[model samples]
Structure formats: structure tokens, C-alpha cells
Target: MADKEATVYIIDLGHSMGEKHSGRKESNLDFSMRYVWDKISTTVAASRKTWTIGVIGLRTDETNNTLDENGLEGYENISVLQEIGPMSMSALRELRSEIKVSKTKQGDAISAIVLASSMIEDFTKKLKYNRKIILVTDGKGAMDADSLDEVTEKLNDVGIELIVIGVDFDDPDYGFKEEDKPKLKKKNEEILSRLVSQCKKGVYGTMAQAVEELSVPRIKPVRPFKSYDGPLTLGDPETYPNAMSIAVERYFKTKLAHPPSASTVVVNNAPSRSQVDDGDEAIEDNGNGLGAVRQVRAYKVNDPDAPGGKRDVDFDSLERGYEYGRTVVPISDMDESITNLQTKKSFTILGFIPFSSYEPHLSMGEAGVIVAQKFNEKAELALSSLVNALYELQSYAVARYVNKDNQKPFLHLLIPDPKLESEADCLFDVPLPFAEDIRSYQFPPLDKVVTVEGTVLRTHRLLPTPDLSKAMSDLVDAMDLSKFGKDDDGNPTEYAPIDETYNPTIHRINQAIRHRAVHPEEPLQPPAEILLRFSKPPDELVDQVKKQIDILIKKADVKKVPPKVKGKRKRETVKPISGLDVDALLGQAKRTKIDPENAIPEFKQTLGAATEVKAIEEATKQMGDIVCTLIRESFADINYDRAAAHLGVMREELIALEEPDLYNNFLRDLKKKIYQKELDGDRMDMWRGKIIAGGLGLITDQELEVSSITEAEAKKFEK
Candidate 1:
């Protein structure tokens, strides 16, 4: 089950928010919106039905919230931008239009908070949810301080997490302070900050902190899913009196995440005359009139008695088959049951092994957590004792686990994790790989070279010199991230923390998706600066290891490779790296004759040695004649292979020389002669087998556009 959340984002749109501060180009409202947009975009990307969001516009021109509609006082200039519901791209587009600088600044921030709390309470009613309220403002507007205590109590009573983010606010912990002397703004900031501090669960920070932290990817909070919740046993209770049974629950510790995939869409054709009167669209447009395409699959099998030598079968008629080597092995229901391992859901302690005996590489799957079953005090005490004993003895428990009935069992390595602060003790478990699953692939030794004569030599080019090896080691040490950053108290810390590093692929894709949804006509923006910030080493670190890098480069004798030319055939042919004009030199000879016995090699030499157009035409014409002669004079099917070999050589040479017309034009004329029985007496079998089967037909545009074969002509010639 997915978790339910109702979060309301209150953004101040007062007239003062339109002014720039601290020489920044963007307005204060836009600066504050950076945090708001990111939070909303994340929820939209999740696409979870239960993750609902609401938006409120503070200090707006008009009053339109639940309070203002009910004729409540002090709710003026505050409007509900959106209701609590699952967010979508359409909702984001609507919100973008609504969040702009307002003409008035009469609304009170505390009053807006009260109305937001009322909205969540009324919508959620008595249902349990992860309720939250986020407010981003510049603290430039007036805020009523009366009933502040009561509002805090109401937020805590309903379990709403209040996060207040002020623009240009002071926070000693964050080391930020706005250099100003406005008493009214200072008072508003203090009031909002106090409201957050008084709440039961919340965070109070500056907008700068929130915006700066947005680069780090947000980890989605998932509802704990119990894989199993039953008594874990050692030995059967009926078989041994000393058998053990403890109520334990297993939950996934980590799960894989994937970005949303796009469905294919097709254009909608015009409707018929009868359906033209209706205004209904064929399907939903993706910003264009293109609608999602429907997929139709037909299963068929070869049937000599059926039409077209094939018959279609319903999907239900298909049977599942398992692949055994190269063949599919199908089994009946009874046989499948016999083949499957019939085991009940169980987690049993198979045995214990020393922690040193376990290898981390042996863990194959995602880790799972096992804790004592809820409300079972005795089970908790027993599991805690087991965890303590395992920790003290430096041992791990190997358990046989079957997550469900009739499922295959797997071995799990259970490592104890004990907390000294009186937290519940639990075991971290990883499924172990079977011996058959491990692959022992062999690779040639990198430190030494073994000659084909079975002699080993260590001082070869494959082996790195001692100087190069030491230089590489020194470079690695110089670029170490450990102790690269200063902590809050000015202590050394890791530069790229694990919690801060994000998956660039996931976030970059999501950013592009959201951008396209909002602005279909515009090109996608570049990747966010934060996503690419950690891709390279720190510049200072690179500068420090300049000497080491230079030494390593010299030792390895590395040289820059030339850039590859794109679309060589689209323009003109690229020159060879040897800088020699082989074609021009070869064309100077103007060779014509090609030996029929040595047709392939001799034909290649004629093409490679030719430096003129007439020489190429002569050689190609002679080769075409040789191919037809081989097929025409063959004793039945004896010379078919020889003819096919000659055709293959002609095709390869034309493609290399970017002269597709030379091969395609000749092949087409040859195909016509064979099909029309002009080459030999009824040699269609050779045409079908060697010409069609070997794919030695015409050269399409895929080979090169220099060919004379039209799209229709290419298809007709293939048949």
C-alpha cells in the first residue's frame, strides 16, 4: 500500500516580493519560487495517487479561500491556488500561471496558516495521513500575531508538519543574515520562525538553504511492506523439545527505482462524414493532435493447410514454455507442479558461521530487515538476546527463507546490528548466491605477458613501469575526497557525501520530462548545475596533482587521438590517416581485364588500382558479365557458390569506394536477366537461393544515396 500525504505550499505573492535584492537579477518572489517549484515537481514526478498536494497564494489581490468564502475576517488577499488532490502536469501548468506578484500586501501570514490548517483538517477528516504545510515568503508583508499560540496548538493537535522558509532571513546555525534595518520585516520573520519552532514536527530555515539543498535528490519515503510476519523456527516443534520459535517480521531495506516510461502515440486520421458532426476528439492529444496508439498482437503458426501457409490463434490458446538450452520445453500442469519445489513459507536458522568466513561479494540481492513481531514483548527479548550473542561471538546466522507458499527457498546471511542507546536490535539480511550462480571468468594477466610458446615475461609493454605506477598512485592519493570539506564546527569531512550524491540519469530525465510538459514549444533546458557538479574532481584537487598527472602522462607516452569525422559519406569521403591518395594513384593505371578463375581478388585489385571513371566502369561491367557467365555455364548448382562470391566482392568494393551505383545498377540488370530466363535455362532456384538468401540484391539508400535504386525499385528487385 502507498502512503497518503496532504501537503500545502503557501507562497507569498505580495507587491514587495517583485523587487530585486542583493544585486540579484531575479525578483524575491522568483527566488522563493525556486524551492516551491522543485518540491511540487518531485511530487508530480512520483505520480502516486495518494501523494496529494495543495497550493495557497498569500498577500494576493483577492480573497478566495474557505475562510474568505465563509465571510471570516482577516482572510482578505489570501486565496487557495489549488485544492488537495493528486498533482499532475496540468496542475503544475495551472499553478505556474497563478503564482505571480500580487497587487496587494494586506493578507496576514499567521491568518493564512490558520486557513491552510483548516483546509487539511476538513479534507482529511478523521483519516490518517502525512500532513504537512510549507510556507515560502520574503517576510515583507504584515502578519497578525494574535492567536499565534492557538494556531501552533492546532497544527500539533492535527499532526501537521510546518516548515517555514523565509527569504533573506537570519539563521546563526546556517551562517546567514540579511543586511537590513527594517523592523516590520524582522518582526514577521521572528513570528514565522517561532511558529515553526513551537510545532511538534517541522523545520525552520532560510530560503537560501532550501534552494541550495534542492540539488541533492530527495529519497522517497515508502510505506514498510512486510514480506513475512510469522514465527521463525529452527527445528520442528513436534520433532525436538528444544526447538526454538520466535515471532519475526521481514521488510525490504532497499528497493530499485526507475523513471517513468513514455507510451507511443500515433496521429489521428480524419473522421467519416457520419462521424464528422460530432465534436469529440479521436483520443487525448499530447499537446499535439497525436493520440496514444493501440497495440494489437496476433499469434500465428505455420500451417500448410491454412491460407497463406499460416493460421492465427487466440492468445488464450498459447501455452507457457521454459527454455532448455536452445529448445523450448513445455510441461503439463501436473508435470509443472512436480517440477516446482513445494515448500511452505518459512524462515529457519540453518546454522551459524564466523563473520570472518563471510565474503561481501557472496551477497547477491537487495538487503532485507528482520525484527520482532509487533506487540510481542517475549519475541523482542528473545531476538535481542540472539542479536547480542551473535555480536559478541563475532558470528552470523545463515537462515533458509521462503517468502511465500510453494516458492523456492534461498539462503540469507543474517548480520546483527546492535545499538548502544537502547534501540530495538535487528538483523540485516542479504540473500546469498548459490555456487552455480557464480561465474569464474578468466582474463589474461595484466602484470605479465604470456607468449603463444608458453613463456612468461614481466618486462613487456603490457606491464606498467614502476615510475608510471607510482605516479598513478600519487595522483589517486592527491585527489582523495576524504577531509576535503569543512563541517559545521570547521572540522574536516568528506567532499562528496553519500547522502548528497544523486543518480544523474534519473533526475536529468525527470527534469526533461517536466520541462517538456510545461513548455511543449521550447527546447529542453540543460541539466541542472547540481546534477553535474560532482561529475568531475574539484578543480583545486586537480591543480594540486598536476605534477603527478604530468609525470604519469610522460611515463605512459600517451598521445591525443584525432577526432573522428561524422557523416563521412554525406559530405565527401574522408582522407586516410596515411595521407596517401591511393584511389588517384590506382586510377592512373586504368586497368581493365579481370581473370574469371580468380574473379574476386582480381576484381578487387582492378577497383583498388583504378584511378579513372572509365577504368571503374570497365572493371564493373566485366565482373557483372563474369557473375552471369558462372551461373549460365554451371553444371546444375556446381558454380552457384562461385557466382555468389563474386557478387559479394563487387558489393564490398562499391560500398568502400562510395560508388553504390556501380554495384546496384549492374545487380538490377543481372537480376532481370536471371528472372526472365535470359542468363540460363530456368535458373530461378539459383536466383532464390544464392541471390535472395545471401541478401546480394540492390543497394538501397541505407548503403549510400549514390545508388540509382528508387524505394519502389529496391523493393521490387528484392522480390
Candidate 2:
């Protein structure tokens, strides 16, 4: 299991591959390609540079391999579809198109294997790479058995693994045996079996079995990387007399993994001439060219002397700068180096504190394990003593860690975890936040309200009452999940175990990608039940808390607010319970004017007294005249607010009466007269500040039903 791999697939592309085999609707070539596509797609999804792939088509119509091109014999009808290199989406497209049935079914599988071996060996001569050769065939074409021994020895010497897959081949173990198979096909299968058997590392199996196992999910093995490895020192070893050091190594205990991010692509309608364009004839056009889009950036600054009032600058001409208060301080590369804090690689302990004094919430980032040096008995004993002593005292150590020379220093907390019986004598370390990383935000007190006079009240509306508190506590108690589920023996246990709850975001994305790769045509299935197991509360738990929830809602006085109606507004006025005539009786002697001294109340009473649209219209005219007179006779800005308030009331009353045209027309005339200085010498302040700012300019169709006013016309009128 090496990190670097060089796997080449020798796919059979003979004429017979285009034909169907035993009860399968798809051709043999398409059926076998399911496995190849899945494997290659997985490698592409990983996006690793070390995982490379090569494809060699066997039993092709032409000869275009290294062996045949070099004038060597017995290597015809074989082509090198793709060179061994870093596999990407572009290379995958080329390999897929290169795999097609040939007109002539005359080629040797053994020769194709040799060709693949030479390509792999030439590319990875003495380097450390996991070399593998996979040959897929229906065994219908010829396979020379003369150089079997030599090829087997060469593969073993080169340390290459061989795998041969036969489509519709006999396999007693798989409960499949093709009846009445051709003589040549049987002989070729036997030859392939022997070739795999003689090799040191090989696997000979039927293609059906391999394709069936493609749906099973596999876990990728990761190589362990050390985050830090140095001495754990208490006090400066060179400065203190009681200083001590323990040789130790550190490895990740909880490493983070990220899901694959989606890339932006654009479908090109024509051939692209850009250098980074990915569309070519090798990829299927599907009636439209598809290419990955690339992002470009530019920098510009405003310049009065330049054309278009802007000047473009090259990115290389710019220097990095940081903000200092209200100004930016530019620092050159040389100046930055002088200001940077540099340190050497070391792990030194600062001091120890009681476990009670150290807060668990302060520890952040990935956790790691600090262990004694490997195969060093003295270091192991010394570290073990430290672990046990810290464990007994219930204390933790604070340490300063520098990963490498010139690297930034970080604070870490190391907690003792000693269980020698299970060989777990180690200290777990987690990164600690600096003072700059800690955030302190002040929030208002939840239990009491403080008045402006420094009086503290605990019985305010924001505070919960005794019955409300009790009801909440009862609801919380009923929703407890501990010991809620039954175990195998029918005993109560924890409802949701930590190990059984899978991360929905991580697993769901992976499942979708895998399904798409295997079944390109079928719709995606629902997420597995295990992934959604802990998404919601159990039915039994919800049923038991129904009554408690109702009690809590009643005690808290919880009520749902009515939804706000948008677009259209309707005014609802309730009719009197008893037959009465209040506004109608007052309107019998309709007051024709609004008093200037008490205009607001008198104007409101006039409108309230109106019983018909004609009376409402007449009242609006009187108020409008009074508002104009107030602005005309005001001493300065004294009556600006009063005029605005009167206009606001008129606007609301007319809108309620479904006669917005009256207010709109009056406002228009007032704006025109005030701007022209026809009312007095200058009244622009009242017109701009009151009419414009107070939103008393116009009434549109949105607020009134009968009157019509376009939004654009209203804006023009206000302006």
C-alpha cells in the first residue's frame, strides 16, 4: 500500500466485445466499463497528483504501440490509448473515446500485457510506486502462450501486480459456469489463469464479480503525518537548575477532512481559443461545447489626469500594506522581515495550573497526542512518571510550541491521560487561543430590567414569572433523551449514541457522487436511513411532551401573530353594536372651515363627522388651505412640523376614504407654489424638509383603491 500508484488498464476492444453476453442487455464492453469508469472517477475525485493511470486498448483495428512502431514482430492490432501521467477529467474523456470496438478481432492479450508492463517500467524505473497491470478480455481473441514464463518472471522482478478479468468466464466459486463455451476461449482463460498464478502478486477473476462489487463503498487509507516531534521541557534547560526534558513525539488525534468543492463551468457554443480552454474533439460535444470557466482579476484607481478618470496598474507594481487607525502604512519586504517575530523549533513548558482553574472552552483546533520516544525505555519511564504525577494532582500543563525555525509561536494545553494497563500513557494537547482571539461582548441582563434612575426591577414584562419558569422546567424534564430507548435485552439506554450519529453533510455528498459515477442514467436514491437517524426527535418522545408543551405555551402567553398582507391593503371598520349616529349627527351642521388655532383636532373631528365621500372631499379642501396659510405666515421653521403633521393626517384620511386624487392634487399645487415663491418670499425649507422627508408628498394606487397614481409620477411630483 504505497502512496504513489501507477495502474494501467488493458481493455479488450475486439469485435466480439460489441456483442451481448449471458442475459445482459448491454454489450460486454459497456458492462465491463462500469468498473473502469468507477475506479477512474474515484481517482479523479481524490485530485491527488501521485495517483496516475494509463490505458492500452487490446485487439484494436490498427497497430500503434511502442513495440509495433519500433519494427518488432507479434505486437499488431494494439494501441496505447493514453500515456501514464497524472489522471484528470480531461484525460478521462480521451481514454473513454479511445475505447471502441475494432473491425478485426485479431490480437494477443499476452502481448498487450507486455506492452503495458514496458510502459509502466519505463515511467517509474527505480522510484517507489505501486505498479499494477489489469487485463480485461472476453478471451475470444488469440493469446500466445509461448513467452508466458518469461513475462511472469519479468513482472515479478519488476514488482508489478497482475489482474486478469474475463467477461462471462467460468467461476465455480461465483456459482457461474458458462455451458458449451468455445474451445479457443476456454484455452485462453486457462492461459491467463496460469499467468496470474505464476506471478508473485496477482488476481484472476470474472468481470461479473468485479463489476458487482463496484457499488460497495471503500475507505481510503491515509498516511500518518507527525505535527510536532521534540523534547517536552519544563523550565529553560540551560538557565534553571531543576530543569528536565523528556524526548517525545506528537501525532494527530483528530484530523479534519473536507468534502470536495464544486467548480464553475460554462457551456461554450463554439470552439474556444483561450489557452486554458478544456474543450476538444476528444470529449463528447453533446451538441454544445462544454468548458470550465476561469476567473480573471484587474486593478484600477481613480485619476483625474488619466483618460476616463481611471488608470489601470499592473499587479506586480503594487506593494502590501496594513491599516493603522485611519491610514494605511506600507511596508516593504525588507521592512516586514525586520518587524516579524521569529522563533526556533522547540516545545517548552511554561507552568502548571489546577484543572479547575483551566476552562475546557479555551482549548481549540485539532487535538494531538504527545508520546514518549519510540523504543527508548528511559524516556518512556520519565514521561510515564510525569503523566501519573499530573493525573494524581488533577493538574494540566501550559506550553509554548514553535513548529519550525522562523515560525510563529502558539500556546497549547497538555492534559494528562494515564491508563498504563491499556498502554495509553500519553498527554493530549490542543491549541489555546491568544488574548486577541478571545471575544467579549456585553449583553443586557435577562432576569431583571434597570431603569434610567438606577432602579432594578425583577417583576418586569421581560422577566419570566414563577408559573412560567415551572412550566418550562416541566417541559425540559419531559424531553430528556437519557435512558429513552430499549437495548437488545429490553432495558432502557441512551436514545442516540454518539458513534451511531453520522455527519449528514459529509456522508450525503459522498453517497451522491458514488451513485452518479456508477449509475449515470438512473435517478439518485434517498439518503440512507442511518444518516438521517438522529435528524429529529423520536415519535414516542414527542407524544409524551405534548401536554407539557401545551402547559408551557399557556403559561408563557405565546401567541402567533397574524401574517402581514402585502400588495393590496383593505381598511376594516367595525359597525356599532347598537344603532347609533355619532359622526352623522355631528355632520348635520357641517363645519366649513378648520380653525387655525386648533387645526389638528378640529380637522380630525371634521373628517370623523363626514358620512359621505362628498363631505370628506370638502373637509380635505379646508385642511389643505389651513396648512398652506400656516407655512405662509410662520416666523421661521417654527410651523414646519405642524404643516407636515397636518399633511400626514390628510393623506391618511383621504387614503382611507378611497379618494387619493384629492390629497395628491393638493400636494402638487403646494409644491409648485412653494418652489416658485408664490406663497411668500422663500418656503423651500418647509417644502423640502416637511413634504419630502415626512413622506407626505403623494398617494399612489398601492394605498388607495379608487384614485390612480403611478409611482413614477409621484416621484416626479415630489422632486
What is every candidate's alpha-carbon RMSD to the true fold?
8.0, 10.7
Model 1, 104-125: lDDT tens digits are: 8688989888988998998899
* Model 2 alpha-carbon drift over 4 Å, by segment: 19-25, 44-50, 63-77, 103-111, 138-154, 165-199, 204-218, 260-344, 353-364, 373-381, 392-394, 417-425, 433-719
Q: Give the TM-score of candidate 1.
A: 0.72
- Candidate 2 per-residue lDDT, tens place, 1-719, comes to 44899999999999999999798999999988977877887887777889999999999988889898889888999988888988865566667678788888899999999999999999999999999999889999988899999999999999999999899888888888898899999999999999999999999999899987764445556665687787889988879867889999998887776766885655656544443434432222222245555656667889999999999999888888899998999988889999999799999889898999987788768888899988888889999999999999999998999988899998889989897533759998999987998898998897889999999999989899999989999999999998898898999999988766667777678778756755557898787677777799989899999999999999999999986442122455445777676557567666668787888788777766666667777788888888888898888888888888888988887676667778888988898889898877799999888788877878877665455777888788776
* Separate clash counts for every candidate: 5, 0
Candidate 2 worst ten-residue window by lDDT: 279-288
